[model samples]
Target: MGRVTGKRVVITGGASGMGRATAELFAREGARVAVLDAQAEPGEAVAAAIRDAGGDARFFRADVSVERSVGDAVDGAAEAFGGLDVLVNCAGIIGVDKPTHEVSEAEWDAVFAVDVKGVFFATKASVPHFLTAGGGAIVNFSSIYGLIGNDEFTPYHVAKGAVNMQTKQDAASYGRHGIRVNAVNPSTVLTPLVEGIARDFPGGLPAYEEQMTGHQSLRRLGRPLDVAYAVLFLASDEADWITGVVLPVDGGYTAR
Candidate 1:
């Protein structure tokens, strides 16, 4: 049997990127999944793909950063799967990039709203179910930028940093309740988020990978699945005692 056999999972930002990849992988390992995203078209497509592959899946259209939408998304998942066991907070935005001083207030707020507040909403909505079920896993998608600061991502960096701290605090509060909370801090991956950043750079992917890989001890760019595998392990009972930790899936990028 697959590691996640018969479990029910709720994945935010499940329409694309790392979120989509992880959700699909989780389904492959035997979890029933509910994909939540603001983009209905792609979200439904992903859900359809999973279901077609003989895995149980459903899709919901909702914005994670909004309270009403987030609540609805949780309800949608609960309706689809009966209850939730895994809450993956992957819905996030890169937001406007600039030096801290040049970044607009709106830019900062928008980043936190999606990256930070979204996690709060998902956890708040899922905690009751988790407590009722006697336990569950909450995986927060943080970043290496959160662990280490960088230029051109003032707000994103701070938001991720907050995500890390929030993960820890939530773990502390919910551990006794049987909920395990953890954050995955990944280095630059070959995601659309990085593709967008590559646009501003002259050499594009080559230059992007060069700089990103150079920082890592492994010196190789990370794939979405790299982070996904980490999430899977943490989402599974394998990581039963790994709460309140910033598990860096950064290809040794943070060792330096």
Candidate 2:
């Protein structure tokens, strides 16, 4: 049951969706979790829930897009846990859905600020701590769009591609020191945000689900836990020999 026993983990965007699921799962598997997010209330609630369930957890408020915020938050969590063992960069946005030509500079910058720069900031801040510990693990949340292109969310796809490269580069940079860095590319997961969108779709939730699942070989949208399990594997010792890999948890969406 203790897949990550005694590990200390810091998860960005732990307040909701896949990030929330990863936090909870890590805690359940015996990791002391730090839930870092801009959403104070929900982040606190997530921490409280974990504590209520007899898990070690705390909430740290931080804007991932800012270097200082990420640095402070990572340090705080490491201090609180006595050291850090893992970092999960899960906070991201779909950004403006316009094509590259129609996108404004500001819009493009905004998406990269969070999706790309946030990953950089968090990883940069965590490296020193990992170096101190002599080793650590990092699981970045990229997307299927990072591996394959679609017409929508061009900025997001590009940012995630950057993340994939970042993952590999850092893995190469740190592997000799025992640090492992990997990324997971998730397809259309049925998170609350997606559910809301489906509800408002022209043909309602059923049609939206069908359309979304049509491209996937599994013919169904993902659940947060599905991706969380992959994160857990990458973060755990079982994957100690695995680094610089971009695993797809997309229900075979890329296969097609």
Best-fitting candidate, measured by lDDT? 2
lDDT per residue as tens, model 2, 5-104: 9999999999999999999999999999999999999999999999999999999999999999999999999999999999999999888888989999
Clashes of each: 0, 0
Highest TM-score among the candidates is held by which one?
A: 2
How many pairs of residues collide in model 2? Answer: 0
Q: Enumerate residue pairs that collide in model 2.
A: none
Cα shift from native, residue 57, model 2 (Å)? 0.4
Please list the residue runs of candidate 1 whose C-alpha ends up more than 4 Å from where it truly belongs after superposition: none
State the C-alpha lDDT per candidate. Answer: 0.90, 0.95
Model 2 residue runs over 4 Å out of place are: none
| Per-residue lDDT of candidate 1, residues 56-152 (tens digit) | 8999888888888998889778867888899999998888768888988888899989999999998898888888789999999999889987776
- Candidate 1 achieves a global lDDT of 0.90
Q: What TM-score would every model get versus the actual structure?
A: 0.97, 0.98
Error of 2 at 163 (Å): 0.6
